[model samples]
Target: MNEWLIGLPEDQAVFVARVAIAFVVCLGAVIGSFLNVCIYRIPIGQSIGKPRSHCPSCGRMIPWYLNVPVLSWLILRGRCANCKAPISVRYPIIETLTAMLFLMVFQMWGNPAIFGLVRLQEPLLIPVYWAFAATIVVNSAIDIDHGILLDRFSLGAMPIALALSGFFPGMHGESVWTQGLIDSAVGLVGGFAGLWIIGLIGSLVFRKEAMGFGDVKWMGLFGALFGWQACVFILICASLLGAVAGLVLLLSRKAALCSAIPFGPYLGASALIWLFWGPRLLDWYVSLIVPAAL
Candidate 1:
Protein backbone atom coordinates (compact mmCIF):
# COMPACT_ATOMS: atom_id res chain seq x y z
CA MET A 1 0.00 0.00 0.00
CA ASN A 2 1.15 3.54 -0.66
CA GLU A 3 2.45 5.43 2.38
CA TRP A 4 -0.32 7.99 2.06
CA LEU A 5 -3.01 5.34 2.17
CA ILE A 6 -1.44 3.24 4.87
CA GLY A 7 -0.51 6.14 7.12
CA LEU A 8 -4.13 6.56 8.20
CA PRO A 9 -5.03 5.57 11.77
CA GLU A 10 -6.44 2.12 12.35
CA ASP A 11 -9.79 3.58 13.26
CA GLN A 12 -9.90 5.34 9.94
CA ALA A 13 -9.23 2.13 8.13
CA VAL A 14 -8.42 1.91 4.41
CA PHE A 15 -11.42 -0.34 3.99
CA VAL A 16 -13.57 2.48 5.34
CA ALA A 17 -12.59 4.62 2.38
CA ARG A 18 -13.90 2.03 -0.05
CA VAL A 19 -17.09 1.71 1.90
CA ALA A 20 -17.53 5.43 2.10
CA ILE A 21 -17.09 5.85 -1.62
CA ALA A 22 -19.58 3.12 -2.37
CA PHE A 23 -22.08 4.59 0.08
CA VAL A 24 -21.81 8.04 -1.43
CA VAL A 25 -22.25 6.70 -4.95
CA CYS A 26 -25.29 4.69 -3.99
CA LEU A 27 -26.77 7.54 -1.99
CA GLY A 28 -26.32 9.96 -4.83
CA ALA A 29 -28.01 7.61 -7.26
CA VAL A 30 -30.94 7.15 -4.90
CA ILE A 31 -31.20 10.89 -4.26
CA GLY A 32 -31.12 11.56 -7.96
CA SER A 33 -34.00 9.17 -8.42
CA PHE A 34 -35.94 11.09 -5.76
CA LEU A 35 -35.05 14.37 -7.41
CA ASN A 36 -36.92 13.20 -10.47
CA VAL A 37 -39.98 13.13 -8.28
CA CYS A 38 -39.31 16.69 -7.16
CA ILE A 39 -38.80 17.85 -10.72
CA TYR A 40 -42.13 16.47 -11.86
CA ARG A 41 -44.14 17.27 -8.76
CA ILE A 42 -42.88 20.70 -7.67
CA PRO A 43 -43.97 22.35 -10.88
CA ILE A 44 -47.52 21.10 -10.64
CA GLY A 45 -47.93 21.79 -6.91
CA GLN A 46 -47.74 18.15 -5.93
CA SER A 47 -46.14 16.82 -2.75
CA ILE A 48 -42.84 15.16 -3.59
CA GLY A 49 -42.70 12.66 -0.76
CA LYS A 50 -46.37 11.80 -0.74
CA PRO A 51 -48.28 9.26 -2.84
CA ARG A 52 -45.09 7.28 -3.34
CA SER A 53 -43.35 6.59 -6.69
CA HIS A 54 -46.10 5.66 -9.09
CA CYS A 55 -46.80 5.72 -12.78
CA PRO A 56 -48.65 8.86 -13.89
CA SER A 57 -50.44 6.90 -16.54
CA CYS A 58 -51.99 4.17 -14.41
CA GLY A 59 -51.23 5.51 -10.90
CA ARG A 60 -49.68 2.18 -9.96
CA MET A 61 -47.12 2.13 -7.14
CA ILE A 62 -43.66 1.23 -8.39
CA PRO A 63 -42.37 -2.08 -7.02
CA TRP A 64 -39.06 -2.31 -5.19
CA TYR A 65 -37.27 -4.22 -7.97
CA LEU A 66 -38.65 -1.86 -10.57
CA ASN A 67 -37.45 1.19 -8.64
CA VAL A 68 -33.80 0.22 -8.43
CA PRO A 69 -32.41 3.41 -9.94
CA VAL A 70 -30.71 2.89 -13.33
CA LEU A 71 -30.85 -0.90 -13.41
CA SER A 72 -34.60 -1.06 -12.93
CA TRP A 73 -35.34 1.18 -15.91
CA LEU A 74 -33.24 -0.95 -18.16
CA ILE A 75 -34.77 -4.18 -16.88
CA LEU A 76 -38.29 -2.96 -17.48
CA ARG A 77 -37.36 -1.61 -20.89
CA GLY A 78 -38.33 1.92 -19.77
CA ARG A 79 -41.99 1.06 -19.56
CA CYS A 80 -44.39 1.00 -16.64
CA ALA A 81 -44.98 -2.62 -15.65
CA ASN A 82 -48.68 -2.19 -15.18
CA CYS A 83 -49.63 0.20 -17.95
CA LYS A 84 -46.73 -0.37 -20.32
CA ALA A 85 -46.55 3.40 -20.56
CA PRO A 86 -43.19 4.51 -21.86
CA ILE A 87 -41.25 6.05 -18.99
CA SER A 88 -39.40 9.22 -19.60
CA VAL A 89 -35.69 8.67 -20.08
CA ARG A 90 -35.02 11.20 -17.29
CA TYR A 91 -34.95 8.70 -14.41
CA PRO A 92 -31.93 6.76 -15.60
CA ILE A 93 -30.23 9.91 -16.77
CA ILE A 94 -30.56 11.60 -13.39
CA GLU A 95 -29.44 8.49 -11.55
CA THR A 96 -26.41 8.04 -13.79
CA LEU A 97 -25.47 11.70 -13.56
CA THR A 98 -25.73 11.76 -9.79
CA ALA A 99 -23.75 8.54 -9.47
CA MET A 100 -20.99 9.99 -11.63
CA LEU A 101 -20.94 13.21 -9.63
CA PHE A 102 -20.78 11.32 -6.37
CA LEU A 103 -17.91 9.25 -7.67
CA MET A 104 -16.10 12.42 -8.67
CA VAL A 105 -16.50 13.88 -5.18
CA PHE A 106 -15.21 10.68 -3.61
CA GLN A 107 -12.19 10.67 -5.89
CA MET A 108 -11.45 14.28 -5.01
CA TRP A 109 -11.96 14.25 -1.25
CA GLY A 110 -11.73 10.68 0.02
CA ASN A 111 -7.98 10.80 0.59
CA PRO A 112 -6.94 9.01 3.77
CA ALA A 113 -5.02 12.14 4.63
CA ILE A 114 -8.27 14.07 4.88
CA PHE A 115 -9.82 11.61 7.31
CA GLY A 116 -6.64 11.22 9.35
CA LEU A 117 -6.24 14.95 9.93
CA VAL A 118 -8.27 16.06 12.95
CA ARG A 119 -8.61 19.61 11.67
CA LEU A 120 -9.92 18.43 8.34
CA GLN A 121 -12.51 16.18 9.90
CA GLU A 122 -14.39 18.82 11.87
CA PRO A 123 -16.47 20.75 9.31
CA LEU A 124 -17.11 18.00 6.76
CA LEU A 125 -16.86 20.35 3.77
CA ILE A 126 -16.78 17.69 1.09
CA PRO A 127 -20.31 16.47 1.78
CA VAL A 128 -21.45 20.08 1.79
CA TYR A 129 -20.06 20.57 -1.68
CA TRP A 130 -21.79 17.41 -2.79
CA ALA A 131 -25.08 18.71 -1.41
CA PHE A 132 -24.55 22.03 -3.17
CA ALA A 133 -23.96 20.32 -6.49
CA ALA A 134 -26.97 18.12 -5.99
CA THR A 135 -29.12 21.15 -5.20
CA ILE A 136 -27.96 22.86 -8.37
CA VAL A 137 -28.79 19.83 -10.45
CA VAL A 138 -32.27 19.56 -8.98
CA ASN A 139 -33.06 23.27 -9.14
CA SER A 140 -31.72 23.68 -12.65
CA ALA A 141 -33.86 20.85 -13.95
CA ILE A 142 -36.88 22.26 -12.15
CA ASP A 143 -36.26 25.74 -13.53
CA ILE A 144 -35.84 24.47 -17.07
CA ASP A 145 -39.11 22.60 -16.95
CA HIS A 146 -41.23 25.07 -14.98
CA GLY A 147 -39.57 28.35 -15.87
CA ILE A 148 -39.24 28.98 -12.16
CA LEU A 149 -36.98 27.81 -9.35
CA LEU A 150 -38.84 26.39 -6.39
CA ASP A 151 -38.59 28.08 -3.01
CA ARG A 152 -38.32 24.71 -1.33
CA PHE A 153 -35.00 23.93 -3.00
CA SER A 154 -33.43 27.40 -2.78
CA LEU A 155 -34.49 28.04 0.81
CA GLY A 156 -33.28 24.62 1.85
CA ALA A 157 -29.93 25.12 0.15
CA MET A 158 -28.83 28.46 1.61
CA PRO A 159 -28.32 27.45 5.25
CA ILE A 160 -26.47 24.29 4.30
CA ALA A 161 -24.16 26.36 2.12
CA LEU A 162 -23.63 28.81 4.96
CA ALA A 163 -22.81 25.99 7.35
CA LEU A 164 -20.34 24.52 4.89
CA SER A 165 -18.66 27.87 4.38
CA GLY A 166 -18.32 28.27 8.11
CA PHE A 167 -16.75 24.84 8.45
CA PHE A 168 -14.35 24.79 5.47
CA PRO A 169 -10.83 26.16 5.77
CA GLY A 170 -10.32 29.63 4.50
CA MET A 171 -8.45 30.30 1.27
CA HIS A 172 -4.73 31.33 1.41
CA GLY A 173 -4.23 29.58 4.75
CA GLU A 174 -6.16 32.06 6.81
CA SER A 175 -7.94 31.10 10.06
CA VAL A 176 -10.46 28.57 8.84
CA TRP A 177 -13.27 29.28 11.23
CA THR A 178 -13.07 33.07 11.25
CA GLN A 179 -12.42 33.49 7.57
CA GLY A 180 -15.05 30.98 6.59
CA LEU A 181 -17.66 32.76 8.70
CA ILE A 182 -16.70 36.14 7.28
CA ASP A 183 -16.78 34.81 3.76
CA SER A 184 -20.15 33.23 4.31
CA ALA A 185 -21.66 36.45 5.66
CA VAL A 186 -20.19 38.61 2.93
CA GLY A 187 -21.13 36.15 0.24
CA LEU A 188 -24.71 35.85 1.41
CA VAL A 189 -25.20 39.59 1.55
CA GLY A 190 -23.35 40.37 -1.65
CA GLY A 191 -25.11 37.66 -3.58
CA PHE A 192 -28.57 38.65 -2.46
CA ALA A 193 -28.05 42.41 -2.68
CA GLY A 194 -26.19 42.42 -5.96
CA LEU A 195 -28.76 40.33 -7.76
CA TRP A 196 -31.60 42.19 -6.17
CA ILE A 197 -30.24 45.51 -7.45
CA ILE A 198 -29.94 44.21 -10.94
CA GLY A 199 -33.36 42.71 -10.74
CA LEU A 200 -34.77 46.05 -9.65
CA ILE A 201 -33.16 47.78 -12.59
CA GLY A 202 -34.40 45.13 -14.97
CA SER A 203 -37.91 45.37 -13.67
CA LEU A 204 -37.98 49.14 -13.89
CA VAL A 205 -36.71 49.21 -17.45
CA PHE A 206 -38.78 46.34 -18.74
CA ARG A 207 -41.90 47.46 -16.83
CA LYS A 208 -42.49 43.95 -15.52
CA GLU A 209 -41.00 41.36 -13.21
CA ALA A 210 -37.60 40.78 -14.71
CA MET A 211 -35.41 38.48 -12.62
CA GLY A 212 -37.17 35.80 -10.69
CA PHE A 213 -36.73 35.73 -6.92
CA GLY A 214 -35.56 32.16 -7.33
CA ASP A 215 -32.50 33.30 -9.26
CA VAL A 216 -31.61 35.77 -6.57
CA LYS A 217 -32.01 33.19 -3.81
CA TRP A 218 -29.97 30.66 -5.72
CA MET A 219 -27.14 33.17 -6.15
CA GLY A 220 -27.22 33.94 -2.48
CA LEU A 221 -26.91 30.27 -1.70
CA PHE A 222 -23.98 29.98 -4.09
CA GLY A 223 -22.36 32.95 -2.47
CA ALA A 224 -22.73 31.51 0.99
CA LEU A 225 -20.93 28.35 0.00
CA PHE A 226 -18.30 29.76 -2.39
CA GLY A 227 -17.63 33.24 -0.94
CA TRP A 228 -18.18 36.65 -2.50
CA GLN A 229 -15.42 36.47 -5.12
CA ALA A 230 -16.69 33.20 -6.50
CA CYS A 231 -20.20 34.59 -6.47
CA VAL A 232 -19.06 37.42 -8.73
CA PHE A 233 -17.46 34.96 -11.08
CA ILE A 234 -20.68 32.94 -11.08
CA LEU A 235 -22.73 36.00 -11.95
CA ILE A 236 -20.53 36.99 -14.89
CA CYS A 237 -20.18 33.48 -16.23
CA ALA A 238 -23.89 32.74 -15.94
CA SER A 239 -24.81 35.94 -17.73
CA LEU A 240 -22.40 35.27 -20.57
CA LEU A 241 -23.59 31.71 -20.91
CA GLY A 242 -27.23 32.73 -20.73
CA ALA A 243 -26.73 35.33 -23.42
CA VAL A 244 -25.02 32.84 -25.66
CA ALA A 245 -27.74 30.30 -25.11
CA GLY A 246 -30.38 32.90 -25.80
CA LEU A 247 -28.68 33.93 -29.00
CA VAL A 248 -28.38 30.35 -30.13
CA LEU A 249 -32.01 29.66 -29.38
CA LEU A 250 -33.03 32.76 -31.26
CA LEU A 251 -30.98 31.84 -34.32
CA SER A 252 -32.41 28.36 -34.29
CA ARG A 253 -35.96 29.75 -34.18
CA LYS A 254 -36.52 27.93 -30.94
CA ALA A 255 -37.16 30.99 -28.77
CA ALA A 256 -38.53 34.39 -29.60
CA LEU A 257 -36.91 37.63 -28.45
CA CYS A 258 -39.70 38.33 -26.00
CA SER A 259 -39.77 34.85 -24.54
CA ALA A 260 -38.67 34.50 -20.95
CA ILE A 261 -35.74 32.25 -20.20
CA PRO A 262 -35.09 30.96 -16.71
CA PHE A 263 -31.66 32.01 -15.43
CA GLY A 264 -31.32 29.42 -12.64
CA PRO A 265 -29.66 26.78 -14.83
CA TYR A 266 -26.95 29.18 -15.96
CA LEU A 267 -26.31 30.21 -12.39
CA GLY A 268 -26.14 26.57 -11.34
CA ALA A 269 -23.70 25.75 -14.11
CA SER A 270 -21.51 28.74 -13.30
CA ALA A 271 -21.52 27.92 -9.59
CA LEU A 272 -20.39 24.35 -10.33
CA ILE A 273 -17.53 25.64 -12.47
CA TRP A 274 -16.52 28.03 -9.72
CA LEU A 275 -16.68 25.30 -7.12
CA PHE A 276 -14.07 23.18 -8.94
CA TRP A 277 -11.95 25.72 -10.83
CA GLY A 278 -12.72 29.27 -9.73
CA PRO A 279 -9.26 30.46 -8.77
CA ARG A 280 -7.48 28.80 -11.65
CA LEU A 281 -9.95 30.22 -14.13
CA LEU A 282 -9.68 33.64 -12.55
CA ASP A 283 -5.90 33.54 -12.76
CA TRP A 284 -5.98 32.42 -16.37
CA TYR A 285 -8.38 35.19 -17.32
CA VAL A 286 -6.31 37.83 -15.49
CA SER A 287 -3.11 36.68 -17.15
CA LEU A 288 -4.69 36.74 -20.59
CA ILE A 289 -6.33 40.16 -20.30
CA VAL A 290 -3.92 42.06 -18.02
CA PRO A 291 -1.07 42.06 -20.54
CA ALA A 292 -3.39 43.13 -23.35
CA ALA A 293 -4.98 45.92 -21.31
CA LEU A 294 -1.63 47.13 -20.07
Candidate 2:
Protein backbone atom coordinates (compact mmCIF):
# COMPACT_ATOMS: atom_id res chain seq x y z
CA MET A 1 0.00 0.00 0.00
CA ASN A 2 1.12 3.55 -0.60
CA GLU A 3 2.25 5.40 2.52
CA TRP A 4 -0.49 7.97 1.98
CA LEU A 5 -3.01 5.14 1.89
CA ILE A 6 -1.68 3.48 5.07
CA GLY A 7 0.33 6.05 7.10
CA LEU A 8 -2.66 6.98 9.20
CA PRO A 9 -3.56 5.35 12.48
CA GLU A 10 -6.29 2.68 12.30
CA ASP A 11 -9.07 5.11 13.25
CA GLN A 12 -7.80 7.75 10.85
CA ALA A 13 -7.40 5.19 8.09
CA VAL A 14 -11.06 4.33 8.42
CA PHE A 15 -11.99 7.98 8.00
CA VAL A 16 -9.69 8.39 5.02
CA ALA A 17 -11.12 5.32 3.39
CA ARG A 18 -14.63 6.58 3.95
CA VAL A 19 -13.80 9.90 2.33
CA ALA A 20 -12.28 8.13 -0.65
CA ILE A 21 -15.33 5.95 -0.91
CA ALA A 22 -17.63 8.96 -0.81
CA PHE A 23 -15.66 10.68 -3.58
CA VAL A 24 -15.86 7.58 -5.70
CA VAL A 25 -19.58 7.34 -5.05
CA CYS A 26 -20.12 10.93 -6.19
CA LEU A 27 -18.04 10.40 -9.33
CA GLY A 28 -19.95 7.24 -10.14
CA ALA A 29 -23.28 9.02 -9.72
CA VAL A 30 -22.33 11.72 -12.20
CA ILE A 31 -20.99 9.25 -14.77
CA GLY A 32 -24.10 7.16 -14.31
CA SER A 33 -26.22 10.17 -15.29
CA PHE A 34 -24.44 10.43 -18.64
CA LEU A 35 -24.55 6.69 -19.19
CA ASN A 36 -28.34 6.92 -18.96
CA VAL A 37 -28.28 9.15 -22.02
CA CYS A 38 -26.03 6.75 -23.92
CA ILE A 39 -28.23 3.81 -23.05
CA TYR A 40 -31.44 5.48 -24.12
CA ARG A 41 -30.18 7.24 -27.22
CA ILE A 42 -27.88 4.64 -28.78
CA PRO A 43 -30.70 2.18 -29.26
CA ILE A 44 -33.24 4.70 -30.50
CA GLY A 45 -30.94 6.32 -33.13
CA GLN A 46 -30.86 9.64 -31.26
CA SER A 47 -27.82 11.82 -30.88
CA ILE A 48 -26.50 11.59 -27.33
CA GLY A 49 -24.93 15.06 -27.39
CA LYS A 50 -27.73 16.93 -29.18
CA PRO A 51 -30.68 16.07 -26.97
CA ARG A 52 -30.90 17.29 -23.41
CA SER A 53 -32.37 14.83 -20.97
CA HIS A 54 -36.11 14.97 -20.43
CA CYS A 55 -38.76 12.96 -18.72
CA PRO A 56 -39.62 10.11 -21.10
CA SER A 57 -43.26 10.27 -20.13
CA CYS A 58 -43.87 14.02 -20.20
CA GLY A 59 -40.94 15.40 -22.27
CA ARG A 60 -40.19 18.00 -19.58
CA MET A 61 -36.51 18.98 -19.64
CA ILE A 62 -34.94 17.82 -16.39
CA PRO A 63 -33.65 20.69 -14.28
CA TRP A 64 -30.07 20.47 -13.07
CA TYR A 65 -30.94 19.87 -9.44
CA LEU A 66 -33.60 17.38 -10.39
CA ASN A 67 -31.07 15.39 -12.38
CA VAL A 68 -28.61 14.80 -9.58
CA PRO A 69 -28.02 11.12 -10.18
CA VAL A 70 -29.23 8.78 -7.45
CA LEU A 71 -30.20 11.59 -5.11
CA SER A 72 -32.73 12.97 -7.58
CA TRP A 73 -34.41 9.63 -7.91
CA LEU A 74 -34.66 9.29 -4.15
CA ILE A 75 -35.86 12.86 -3.54
CA LEU A 76 -38.50 12.52 -6.21
CA ARG A 77 -39.62 9.18 -4.79
CA GLY A 78 -38.70 7.42 -8.04
CA ARG A 79 -41.18 9.52 -10.03
CA CYS A 80 -40.75 12.37 -12.44
CA ALA A 81 -41.41 15.67 -10.68
CA ASN A 82 -43.01 17.08 -13.84
CA CYS A 83 -45.47 14.26 -14.54
CA LYS A 84 -45.33 12.04 -11.43
CA ALA A 85 -44.66 9.11 -13.76
CA PRO A 86 -42.64 6.41 -12.02
CA ILE A 87 -38.95 6.43 -12.87
CA SER A 88 -37.09 3.27 -13.64
CA VAL A 89 -34.79 2.03 -10.87
CA ARG A 90 -32.24 1.47 -13.65
CA TYR A 91 -31.07 5.09 -13.42
CA PRO A 92 -29.91 4.95 -9.80
CA ILE A 93 -28.50 1.46 -10.21
CA ILE A 94 -26.47 2.48 -13.26
CA GLU A 95 -25.19 5.59 -11.55
CA THR A 96 -24.11 3.69 -8.44
CA LEU A 97 -22.46 0.96 -10.50
CA THR A 98 -20.55 3.49 -12.60
CA ALA A 99 -19.21 5.11 -9.43
CA MET A 100 -18.11 1.76 -8.03
CA LEU A 101 -16.21 0.90 -11.23
CA PHE A 102 -14.47 4.28 -11.20
CA LEU A 103 -13.34 3.79 -7.61
CA MET A 104 -12.13 0.31 -8.36
CA VAL A 105 -10.06 1.54 -11.34
CA PHE A 106 -8.62 4.32 -9.15
CA GLN A 107 -7.67 1.92 -6.40
CA MET A 108 -6.10 -0.50 -8.89
CA TRP A 109 -3.70 2.13 -10.25
CA GLY A 110 -2.94 4.66 -7.51
CA ASN A 111 0.22 6.22 -8.90
CA PRO A 112 0.00 9.67 -10.45
CA ALA A 113 2.53 8.66 -13.13
CA ILE A 114 0.37 5.77 -14.26
CA PHE A 115 -2.75 7.91 -14.16
CA GLY A 116 -1.11 10.83 -15.95
CA LEU A 117 0.69 8.69 -18.47
CA VAL A 118 -2.44 6.73 -19.32
CA ARG A 119 -4.75 9.76 -19.77
CA LEU A 120 -6.52 8.80 -16.57
CA GLN A 121 -5.99 12.38 -15.38
CA GLU A 122 -8.56 13.60 -17.85
CA PRO A 123 -12.19 14.03 -16.79
CA LEU A 124 -13.15 12.58 -20.16
CA LEU A 125 -11.58 9.19 -19.41
CA ILE A 126 -13.98 8.70 -16.53
CA PRO A 127 -16.98 9.10 -18.76
CA VAL A 128 -15.25 7.24 -21.56
CA TYR A 129 -14.79 4.16 -19.42
CA TRP A 130 -18.32 4.57 -18.12
CA ALA A 131 -19.60 4.70 -21.68
CA PHE A 132 -17.49 1.71 -22.59
CA ALA A 133 -18.89 -0.23 -19.66
CA ALA A 134 -22.34 1.12 -20.40
CA THR A 135 -22.10 -0.13 -23.98
CA ILE A 136 -21.53 -3.60 -22.61
CA VAL A 137 -24.25 -3.20 -20.01
CA VAL A 138 -26.81 -1.86 -22.45
CA ASN A 139 -25.95 -4.40 -25.11
CA SER A 140 -26.09 -7.24 -22.63
CA ALA A 141 -29.35 -6.06 -21.12
CA ILE A 142 -30.99 -5.62 -24.51
CA ASP A 143 -29.66 -8.95 -25.66
CA ILE A 144 -31.11 -10.61 -22.63
CA ASP A 145 -34.41 -8.87 -23.19
CA HIS A 146 -34.65 -9.34 -26.97
CA GLY A 147 -31.95 -11.87 -27.95
CA ILE A 148 -29.87 -9.38 -29.93
CA LEU A 149 -27.07 -6.87 -29.50
CA LEU A 150 -27.69 -3.49 -31.10
CA ASP A 151 -25.02 -2.49 -33.64
CA ARG A 152 -25.14 1.21 -32.87
CA PHE A 153 -23.81 0.87 -29.31
CA SER A 154 -21.11 -1.71 -30.01
CA LEU A 155 -19.89 -0.14 -33.25
CA GLY A 156 -20.00 3.38 -31.86
CA ALA A 157 -17.46 2.46 -29.17
CA MET A 158 -14.68 1.48 -31.61
CA PRO A 159 -13.36 4.93 -32.45
CA ILE A 160 -13.32 6.02 -28.84
CA ALA A 161 -11.47 2.89 -27.85
CA LEU A 162 -9.01 3.41 -30.69
CA ALA A 163 -8.34 7.01 -29.72
CA LEU A 164 -7.78 6.18 -26.06
CA SER A 165 -5.52 3.23 -26.78
CA GLY A 166 -3.57 5.25 -29.31
CA PHE A 167 -2.66 7.98 -26.86
CA PHE A 168 -2.53 6.19 -23.50
CA PRO A 169 0.89 4.89 -22.45
CA GLY A 170 -0.40 2.44 -19.87
CA MET A 171 -2.71 0.83 -22.42
CA HIS A 172 0.16 0.36 -24.83
CA GLY A 173 3.34 -1.20 -23.45
CA GLU A 174 5.60 1.44 -24.95
CA SER A 175 5.33 5.13 -24.13
CA VAL A 176 6.02 6.09 -27.72
CA TRP A 177 2.97 7.10 -29.78
CA THR A 178 4.06 5.04 -32.78
CA GLN A 179 4.35 1.86 -30.74
CA GLY A 180 0.91 2.49 -29.31
CA LEU A 181 -0.43 2.70 -32.82
CA ILE A 182 1.17 -0.56 -33.80
CA ASP A 183 -0.12 -2.29 -30.68
CA SER A 184 -3.62 -1.01 -31.32
CA ALA A 185 -3.58 -2.15 -34.92
CA VAL A 186 -2.32 -5.57 -33.97
CA GLY A 187 -4.90 -5.78 -31.25
CA LEU A 188 -7.73 -4.93 -33.59
CA VAL A 189 -6.69 -7.46 -36.19
CA GLY A 190 -6.04 -10.20 -33.66
CA GLY A 191 -9.27 -9.61 -31.77
CA PHE A 192 -11.60 -9.45 -34.75
CA ALA A 193 -10.05 -12.20 -36.82
CA GLY A 194 -9.73 -14.61 -33.89
CA LEU A 195 -13.37 -14.40 -32.92
CA TRP A 196 -14.62 -14.25 -36.48
CA ILE A 197 -12.91 -17.56 -37.19
CA ILE A 198 -14.45 -19.16 -34.15
CA GLY A 199 -17.87 -17.87 -35.07
CA LEU A 200 -17.49 -19.27 -38.56
CA ILE A 201 -16.48 -22.74 -37.41
CA GLY A 202 -19.18 -22.87 -34.76
CA SER A 203 -21.82 -21.78 -37.22
CA LEU A 204 -20.70 -24.30 -39.83
CA VAL A 205 -20.90 -27.20 -37.38
CA PHE A 206 -24.10 -26.11 -35.67
CA ARG A 207 -25.66 -24.94 -38.95
CA LYS A 208 -26.76 -21.69 -37.36
CA GLU A 209 -25.29 -18.42 -36.14
CA ALA A 210 -23.09 -19.30 -33.21
CA MET A 211 -21.75 -15.82 -32.55
CA GLY A 212 -22.98 -12.42 -33.60
CA PHE A 213 -20.98 -9.73 -35.42
CA GLY A 214 -21.50 -7.41 -32.47
CA ASP A 215 -19.37 -9.75 -30.36
CA VAL A 216 -16.60 -9.70 -32.98
CA LYS A 217 -16.53 -5.93 -32.99
CA TRP A 218 -16.71 -5.79 -29.20
CA MET A 219 -13.65 -8.03 -28.93
CA GLY A 220 -11.86 -5.86 -31.46
CA LEU A 221 -12.54 -2.81 -29.33
CA PHE A 222 -11.24 -4.62 -26.29
CA GLY A 223 -8.12 -5.59 -28.21
CA ALA A 224 -7.52 -2.09 -29.52
CA LEU A 225 -7.54 -0.86 -25.92
CA PHE A 226 -6.06 -3.76 -23.95
CA GLY A 227 -3.95 -5.64 -26.53
CA TRP A 228 -4.12 -9.07 -28.15
CA GLN A 229 -3.15 -11.17 -25.10
CA ALA A 230 -5.63 -9.49 -22.83
CA CYS A 231 -8.23 -9.88 -25.56
CA VAL A 232 -7.54 -13.62 -25.64
CA PHE A 233 -7.77 -13.83 -21.88
CA ILE A 234 -11.02 -11.93 -22.02
CA LEU A 235 -12.39 -14.32 -24.63
CA ILE A 236 -11.41 -17.35 -22.56
CA CYS A 237 -12.81 -15.95 -19.36
CA ALA A 238 -16.02 -14.88 -21.06
CA SER A 239 -16.45 -18.31 -22.63
CA LEU A 240 -16.05 -19.98 -19.27
CA LEU A 241 -18.43 -17.63 -17.52
CA GLY A 242 -21.00 -17.78 -20.33
CA ALA A 243 -20.86 -21.54 -20.45
CA VAL A 244 -21.46 -21.82 -16.73
CA ALA A 245 -24.27 -19.30 -16.81
CA GLY A 246 -25.87 -21.01 -19.78
CA LEU A 247 -25.72 -24.36 -18.05
CA VAL A 248 -27.31 -22.97 -14.94
CA LEU A 249 -30.06 -21.33 -16.94
CA LEU A 250 -30.74 -24.52 -18.86
CA LEU A 251 -30.72 -26.90 -15.88
CA SER A 252 -32.99 -24.60 -13.91
CA ARG A 253 -35.46 -24.51 -16.83
CA LYS A 254 -35.03 -20.76 -17.00
CA ALA A 255 -33.86 -20.98 -20.64
CA ALA A 256 -33.69 -23.68 -23.20
CA LEU A 257 -30.24 -24.90 -24.24
CA CYS A 258 -30.91 -23.57 -27.72
CA SER A 259 -31.95 -20.17 -26.46
CA ALA A 260 -29.63 -17.39 -27.62
CA ILE A 261 -27.79 -15.87 -24.69
CA PRO A 262 -26.01 -12.56 -25.08
CA PHE A 263 -22.29 -13.13 -24.73
CA GLY A 264 -21.49 -9.41 -24.67
CA PRO A 265 -21.99 -8.99 -20.93
CA TYR A 266 -19.64 -11.85 -20.15
CA LEU A 267 -17.08 -10.30 -22.50
CA GLY A 268 -17.44 -6.94 -20.79
CA ALA A 269 -17.19 -8.44 -17.33
CA SER A 270 -14.13 -10.46 -18.33
CA ALA A 271 -12.49 -7.44 -19.95
CA LEU A 272 -12.94 -5.47 -16.72
CA ILE A 273 -11.46 -8.31 -14.66
CA TRP A 274 -8.54 -8.51 -17.08
CA LEU A 275 -8.05 -4.78 -16.90
CA PHE A 276 -7.65 -4.85 -13.10
CA TRP A 277 -6.34 -8.31 -12.28
CA GLY A 278 -4.79 -9.68 -15.46
CA PRO A 279 -1.23 -10.04 -14.23
CA ARG A 280 -2.20 -11.55 -10.91
CA LEU A 281 -4.65 -13.98 -12.46
CA LEU A 282 -2.18 -14.97 -15.14
CA ASP A 283 0.50 -15.67 -12.55
CA TRP A 284 -1.87 -17.70 -10.42
CA TYR A 285 -3.05 -19.80 -13.36
CA VAL A 286 0.54 -20.40 -14.50
CA SER A 287 1.55 -21.42 -11.01
CA LEU A 288 -1.26 -23.94 -10.78
CA ILE A 289 -0.77 -25.50 -14.19
CA VAL A 290 3.03 -25.37 -14.29
CA PRO A 291 3.31 -27.24 -11.02
CA ALA A 292 0.94 -29.91 -12.28
CA ALA A 293 2.85 -30.27 -15.52
CA LEU A 294 6.23 -30.34 -13.76
lDDT of each: 0.78, 0.76
- The most accurate candidate by TM-score is 1
The regions of model 2 sitting more than 4 angstroms off are: 1-21, 49-51, 75-77, 81-84, 111-131, 138-166, 175-178, 251-253, 256-261
Residue 211 displacement in candidate 2 (angstroms) = 1.2
lDDT of 2: 0.76
> Residue pairs in steric clash, candidate 1?
none
> By lDDT, who's the top model here?
1
Q: What TM-score, to 2 decimals, does candidate 1 have?
A: 0.82
Where model 1 places Cα greater than 4 Å from the true spot, the runs are: 1-4, 7-23, 43-47, 112-123, 171-173, 256-260
Give each model a TM-score.
0.82, 0.77
Alpha-carbon error at 251 in model 2, in Å?
Answer: 5.2
Tell me the tens digit of each residue's lDDT in model 1 across 1-294. 336567778566657677777888898899889888878887888988798899999999998788999998998999999999999998899888878777665555445443443222323456766776787788888887878887777778677666665666453224667787778878888998899999999999999988898889878877777777887899899989988988898888888641655788899989888866787798899999999999
- Per-residue lDDT value at 81 in model 1: 91
